[model samples]
Target chain A: MNLQVVYCNHQTAELDIRERLAFATSDQLSNAYEYLRSHFPQTELVLLSTCNRVELYTAQESQDDAPSHQDIAHFFSDFHEIPLTDFFDDLLERTGPDAVRHLFQVVSSVDSMVLGEPQIVSQVKEAYRTATEYEACGPLTHALFQGAIRVSSRVRTETGLTEGRVSIASVAVGEFGKSIFDRFDDKTVLVIGAGEMAEETLRYLSNEGVRRINIVNRSPDRARALAERWPGAQVHAYEKLEELLVGADVIVSTTGSEKPIVSVGQFSRIRRNHLDKPVFILDLGAPRDFEPGIGQIDDGVFLYDIDDLETTCEQNRIARGTEVERALEIIDDETDRFMREIYHRATGPIVKRLREQWHDISQTEVRSLKSKLGHLGNDDLKAIERSMERLVNKLLHPPLEALKDEAREGTPHGLLDALKRLFHIKD
Target chain B: MVNVNVICFLASYSVVLIMELMRLLGRSPVRRTIMLLFGTAGFAAHTLYLMNRSNQANLPPLLSSSHDWLLVLAWISILMYLFLTTIDRNLAIGLFVIPLVLFLIAAAYFVSDSSMPVLNVSNLRDAQQAALRRWVMLHASLLVFGIAGVIVGLVLSLMYLVQHRRLKHKQTMQRGLRLPSLAVLSRWNWWAVIISVPLLTLGLATGFGVAFLSDEAVPVSMADPVIMIYGVAWAVMAAFFAWLLTTRRPAGKQVAWMTIWAFGFLLVTLVGLQVLAGSGLDSFHAGGTRDSSGLV
Candidate 1:
């Protein structure tokens, strides 16, 4: 089995590079799958494209069909219409056990900018689901992603990595929102989208004691649904967005719109009444629901996009470096356990056949000896058969131990081939 | 049993403060537990020392002397600290509350540990002195609880400002300096100001009542400059307390700032008076105080 990953993350590349390279939508991802299939038909792929990183994981049954780092890079270059040289230095590659470990680390959030964030796990799960939907994933990729998610849970349970501030909502509110306002109970929290992200940010806000919540969306039913989950949260029509925006002390917009929903002119008008009163705006949208210029509308307008929070996230990462180390330790252990299982799966058929072949030969020899020594006492024949069985078991132990040991690092392909030829074992 | 002096409990509080500072570097359950243990041990030693002092002086800790009075204040503050910490280990109330405790214990050293003038009220008739002593106890008791409220207000205000600054700056809650929510702290601070200022007023009124009740031999008169200074400090607090109640829309930051000033002035005046009166620099109080250290 061959496993490989090519990726560019926040640590390796800037946001612009990642955003350009990301498969932003399901349609785009499905198209990427089509392109990948045409290029590496024998390979299984799982592409994870988030705002922070764009990663492509591939696995193959035959080593010959395993695409090189350069091939994946070329695919990114060609699909995005950017030259390979433009991002070749930024693209990183991991193969075999290293690839397996990387996915585990990513899923566990040890590799995330925010060390213990839970969003990465869901993002990875969603990526895997998309891959399966497009028929891009096979047994190898399926097993890899599934193991990655399972290890993610272990890392969370065994380590303190997931203890505090584990989401963008918590980080934004706990870090920025708390800093901006003296108290949340008196503040107005306006959520502009009725999506999961909006609900998540609201959860953090409510935890901080924000009572007056105004959830406005294009769909009134969606807004009502989200409002119902939290008490004291009011639903408003999308037309009343400006009124809600002006009233909100802390505004978190996560609309799934493609372009900027709030332009500088629109927010400038909203700020007429709230010039001195500070407004903390968290634009968690991918394409950005609010224009970047809205951040500079005034000194009172404290605007933060997802990328703006990287510095705060990095500080959180350093603060919890020990938790990261402990989480990584679990990930490493789980990775090895997973790799050993895959290796055992590969070597199981051959090992079973070899054991059956040797046992059959021992039985035949015992039978023939029993017949030849028919003149001897029956007890003597039985004793001789037991001794022959022990002799065969002793002979098989060394090679079998060697095969098991070799399977630790990887499939013992060379040793298995030699054993098959030497023992007349057929698979 | 060995004697546990003020220094013993003071040292314990110092160690708790140091450990609280260390908690700011990172969150550690062991560190928090160790700090609380030291705090508890310190409180035990403090209790022992106060009981010893009160027994030796033949008075309650509050009525014993200026030194014991300060320790009593620190003791109640520590009690509140322990209760808050027990409820929420993450509440970092100690980071704000413990320094005041340490200061009170240390300040006890500078003030006179001698028995109050009422203790040495030998010149007055036995019945008159006895009545004066009861009034003095009521005065100190009211002041101890009331001043506890002042210190609480001051701590709450500081917490409010720090929490506000962190929230405004968009910084993570500094590692272990977690405080109560602003709403809770503000409400507590408001109550601290409102409740404490009145208790302090009644305490002052009782002190004046003692003046009128006692004869000239003890020399506790309302005309004294020390009494006048306390009256002025009371006015400062009263004015702020009134505003806190009347303000239609009280901004937490504004209220917190004014509370810091009002409570801060009250503490300084109270301690300044004790220090001055302890030194026998012509400062005024009830009867005649004998400096146990005989420093004068």
Candidate 2:
């Protein structure tokens, strides 16, 4: 059996290249699986697409049948309508033990942008499930994915990598929100958009006892939906955002608009209405939702944008990197151990078949000797059978030991072939 | 049983405070155990010392002389510290409380050690003298408890500030220095202010009542150094309490800082007045022998 992973991740590719090559939707992923199955009919396929990386993991009974790095890149190029020349150099490939180790690292979040994030494991599980639903996974793919999940769980339990603030929302609230307000229950939380970042931030705030949550989005239905999901939260149209801002103690803006949603003048008016109560504004938008000057309005107004949280997240990332290394080491060791076990399991049947055939030949020879020499009694014949069996076992021990030892590195295919030929053992 | 002295407990607490400070550097289970043992030993010694003083004075520690009175206040604070620290081994209360205990004991050195004249329950005692003694005990007890509350307020405010800073910086709780949540600390601070102010007002009122009841002796006048300074400290705390209650949006940090300033002023004035009064200053004398009545 063979396992392989061909992909480019945050480590190997720039963000722009990854974004261009990424399968961003479930439809795209399903189509990619179709293309993979069409190209390599015998190979099992599971495609993992996240913001940080895009990896295609495939397994097969023979290495030759497994899709190559070029095949996967061409599939991406054809599926996404991107030129092969654009990302061909950025693509990286791992096979055999390396591929298994890479998958283990990915599932364990060792390969994630935020080390120890729990989201990646679930994402991997979803990818595997999707592949299975598409009839793309076989026994090798199933076992590999299951092993990856188990390894991820073990790594999380055994290491301290998951102990601290490992998410953007957690860092934002912890670093900025707590600095602005003493208690969240007494504060009004205004979520500006219904994006995932907003949802994540709201989740953290709600956990901190924020009773009053207001969602203001351009899409009122989405806003209403998000607000309805969380208890005690209310949804408002985007037009009432300024009025909501006046009452909010914490404002989290993550709208996808290209320009600033709230300007200094608008916030200044809101600040006047609210008096000098400290308001924590977390602008999680890319192009900046709240104007830069809003942060400078007064001492009571504290504004933290994506860039500010980025610095803190980076610091935390650095601080936790040592633990990440430790976790990665654990994954590496476990991957090697798992691969060795799989190799041993693969070689087991052939080894058993060879041993049985040799033993049968020895038994027949012992019977012929006992029958030809009538001087031997029943006890003596039994003694000869035991002696012949011991000779056959001793003679077979060296090559079997060598094959098992070679299995540690990988499947000892060459040695097994030689054993089958020499022992005249049929498949 | 070996007789535990003030020095034995004072030294033990001092060592414990130092050990608590060491936790800021790093955590060690051995160090924590040692700190707990020393704290318990100090508390035992403090209790023994108060018991001895109460026994000698033939009065409750709160009704004894100003020296023993202040020690009683310190003893109460130490009890609170020990109770809280024992329950939450991670609390850094010892760092804030032990110093106050040390200051109380240190301030005791300058105050009068002579027991206040006991109120005679027998018929031979003068009505006015008995009345004066009872009023004095009441005044001292109220003031002790009031000051104890102030000490608690001060510590809670300090804790609020520390917790606020840590939360603001997004630092994880240090291994041995767990603090109360902001909500809990704020609630406790509010209670401390609410309770302390009334007790302090009563203590002041009782002081005035005692002065008025004693007609034969010159009453404690407003001009008296101790009385004047204490009044000023009370006014400061009263103003702080007013702001605390009146302001709808005062930050916890602001409240904490105000409490620190006001309570800190009261402590300094209370201790300073006692020390100044002990120097036999004629400016503080009311009607009794300057050597006999002042401070003690």
Candidate 3:
């Protein structure tokens, strides 16, 4: 048997190439699976396509029949309508153990651009499911994907790789926003400006059951666009910032202004009546839309700018980095276990036939001896049969032991062939 | 019966507290499980010790003596701690809770382990003893439960302060010491103060009732130093409770501080007076027929 993977990822290819090569939708992936199945009739295939990587894994029962690197490269060229020269150098290939290890790392998220990310596992699962739906998966791909899923689980629970939030928006909303409020469904979320960071923070808050969202921007069009994405969100005029701030339980500011938008003097005047109410402020702007001193005004205001989150994100990154070695060790151990199983699988049939041929020959000879000797007693015949069996086992033990040992490193194709020829075995 | 003593559980609790402190360095599931194992073993030993005392005196642990009362309070706190930590492995509640439990157990060491004098029904006629026993049970039970509430309030207040400081500084939560959200902590703290003050007040009222009832049978004086100190502590707690209820909207940090002061003062005063009473200071509540077991 043979295993191979030809792919390009964030590390090997630019975004331009990855995007062009990606099967962006299920329909596209189905079409690609159909095309690959028609071209390579004897191979099993699973295609894993995400924003950061595009990998095609194939397995075959015979090494001679497996598609070569050039064949897969040509398939990508013909299927995606891109010339082979455009990405031939960018497309990398791995065979056997390297192929298995690559899939394990990808499924475990060790190969993600954002290290310790959780999405790649689900992406790989979806790819495998799609391959199964298309009937492109056989025993080899099934075992490979199942083993990859198990390895991902082991890496996640055994290591602290996914323990902390590393992104600014995630840290701001997940760590700080959640610590201040018990629940967000009743709290008013105020977005000061329609920046990308604001939208991202809103996404996290929305997931946390936030229902009431108020978007205020100097530009009405941008604010409306932001408000339209959420079902219950409303766009407010920039003039109503102070009124909104008083009502908001959570405030996220990500304006592009060069200086502070809400000054201490202005906020203190507004915060006079709401001193007891807690407000989580995420000032994602570079210059900080909310003044720094407002945080010190009262215990109710939790103001965190980009620098604060960067420190947390950096710490989380370092923590995740430390777990990478442990994760790789797990992956390597799983990879070796998987290769060992596949190699032993290849030697199974030959070993079974060799043993069966020798035992059948011994049984037939023992029966012939009993029939030829008319004076032979029942005990004598039984003793002769036991001796014949022991002789056959003694003769077959050495080569069988060598075959078992050779199977540990990989499939011993040459030795299997020599055994078949020597024993006059068929198939 | 198995011989159980205060040292058995005290040593167990001390080890559990140290293990909880180790979480400041890093989180490990194995460490957490081990901490819980120690905490559970301590709670079991505490239960056995209390049962032995109750068996020796032939009374409930609460009504037996000051030492038994303090141990009952610690037992309740450890029960709460084990329940909370078991349900949520991430809560660093033990860091705030276990030390207070240890303090209560240690306070048991310095207080009188002999049964309360007013509860000594052995000398009275059977009819009068029955009547006195009911009054003492009410007084001791009310006081034990009320003190447990105060301990809970103190732990909640300390947790609120730590969580508030972490949020105010924008520091990431330690992985092992995950606390409740500030809103949840504040809400629970408010309830703790609200519920505990009323209980403590009723407990004081019941104490006065017991003293008045016992005047004819035994000269249970109202001017005992322990009683005087308890009355003063109750007064402080009542004032804080009133402020907490009547104020329009108090800051969370301010409430946390007030709870800490109110509850902290009451605990210290109660434990201090008991220690003084055990040292042979003049108090009707302390001295009685001492049990020979020395299990408290």
Candidate 4:
């Protein structure tokens, strides 16, 4: 049995390179599968495409026909209309046991951009289902994907890998925002900047059912563009910040300012319009756009800076680190077990043939002995037959034991061939 | 039948408090369940003890004696604590509220355990006794409810300050130690102080009103130093409550600290007066000695 994986992830390649290599949708993946079938018809494949990773896993019955690193890399180039030399260096290759271990790590979230994230397992599961839908997977890929999912579950159960909020946006919204407000849909979410970080956080908040999102930035065009991405979002001018502040229930600020933009006095004046209403201010800016004293101004104001989320993120990262080591240990054990099973399966036919051939020889000897000892008692004849069977087993024990031992590391192809010639075995 | 006492329930509440402290380190449903169990057991024993006191004294727990009255207040606080805790699973309210319950119960030990002379058959027949009992009931009920408000205000302010500190300082929440939002706590604190101060003032005013309506034979004095001290405490609280309500842009930290100081003084003054007056054996809150008391 031959298995292989060729992939690039957050660690091996940049985001642009991965995006260029990724299959964006199911149709793309399906077309890629059709292309793969035409090129390497003997191989079974599963394609895993996520924001951070693009991996192709393949398995083949015949080792000789297994797709090589260059072949799969060229397939990607031809399919995407990209030159091979552009990303060939970024593309990595793993085969046999390493490939299996890689898949296990990926599924377990040890290979993710955010270590110990729980999304990768579902991504892999979806990929496997898609492969099955496209008829790209077989028994080997099925067993592998199933085993990887099981390992992911075991890792989640046995470890603290998936415990805390891992991402900055997730930590901000989940750990801080949920604590501030019991519900989000009723609250007005004022996103104070239109940068990528702001957009990312807005995505998290929007997912929390934030119905009213007002994007306010120094640049109105950028604000409008950002607001257009989230559902039911409205864009406002930067000068209307105070009006929006009084109106908003939640504020997410991701301005890249060097100094404080909102002062304590400025907020104090803004708060006069809405004294009792609680406002959650997320200061995700570097050097903090909102002054620290603004949080101190009133009980209705709950202001959080990036440092708050970092502490939580750091603790989560540490927790995930310990779980990662544990997950790796589980992966190692599973990979070894999978390889051993495959090797043991490869040794099956040879062991069966050898056993059958020896049993035939023993039966023939027993028949001859029985014919020669026709005058002997029936009980004596049976005892003599048992002795002949024991003799044949003893004679065949050493070579069969050697063959079984050789199959532990991998399929004992050389030993099986030698045994077939020495025993006059066919097929 | 097993007899339950103050110590029985006080010990139970202490266990609940310890479990609440343990919850600050991390969340454990088992710990919360055990705390609830201890709280329920304690509240049950507390209820039985109050009933026993009332039975022995032939009066309600609030009118029996200062000791019983304080226990009744604690009992009310415990009920609130348990009810709030039952409703909000993630709230670390017990940590903030149980210490007050324990304080009231502990202070009961230092105060008078004596039942008043109002429970006597002879006093029950006296016309003056009926008038005095109404006044005393009004006085005690107003004080109990007012002090309940004070306890709530103090707790809400403390919660507000804690939540404010966590938010302003940008600290991640401690596992299992989550308070309500600052807005909720501040609003609750505002209402608590607003409603409770009036109840307390009415209690003090009624104390004087009762004294004025009584005949000279009762030997009660409105001008007594203890009563004057209570008047002073009431005035101080009245001023603080006025400042709290009138101020439009009260800073959260400022409000939290003021509530702490003002409510802290009110509680200390109220409890100190009871302890001191009860020690002297002649104050209105203390009507009889432990030797003359049926409930003790």
DockQ of each: 0.11, 0.08, 0.60, 0.16
Worst 10 residues of 3 chain A by lDDT: A156-165
Off by over 4 Å in 1: A1-160, A174-188, A193-199, A203-242, A245-249, A254-308, A326-427, B123-125, B286-296
Model 4's lDDT to the true fold?
0.83
- Rank order (by DockQ, best first): 3, 4, 1, 2
Candidate 3 regions exceeding 4 Å error are A340-404, A411-427, B1-8, B125-138, B212-217, B287-296
Candidate 3, A1-427: lDDT as tens digits: 8899999999999999999999998788879998999999899999999999999999999888899999999989998999999999999999988999999999998999999999998999999999999999998999999999999999987777777899998888878888888899999999999989999889999999999999999999999999999999999989988889889988899999999999999889878888998888889998888889999988898889999999999988888898899899989999999988988888888989999999999999988887899799999999999998899999999999999898877778899899999998899
Candidate 2: tens digits of C-alpha lDDT, residues A1-427: 8888889988889999999888888788878887888899999999999989998998887777877788888898988889999889888889888999999988998877778788999999999999999999998888889999999987776655654465578977765566445579888889999999999898999888999998899999889889888999998878888788888888999999999999999888878755547678889999999999987776567677887777667665665576677688888888888888789878998889988898889988987897799998899989988999899999889988999888987988888788889878787
What pairs collide in candidate 3? none
The prediction achieving the highest DockQ against the true structure is 3
- Ten contiguous residues minimizing lDDT sum, candidate 4 chain A: A157-166
Best candidate (score: TM-score): 3
Worst lDDT run of 10 residues, candidate 1 chain B, spans: B287-296
How many times do residue backbones clash in model 4? 0
State residue A195's C-alpha deviation in candidate 2, in Å. 2.1
A161: Cα error in model 2, Å: 7.3
Clashes of 3: 0
Give the clashing pairs for model 1.
A178-B167, A179-B166, A179-B167, A179-B168, A180-B167, A180-B168
Candidate 1 recovers a fraction of native contacts equal to: 0.18
User: Which residue pairs show collisions in model 4?
Assistant: none
Q: In terms of TM-score, how similar is model 3 to the real structure?
A: 0.89
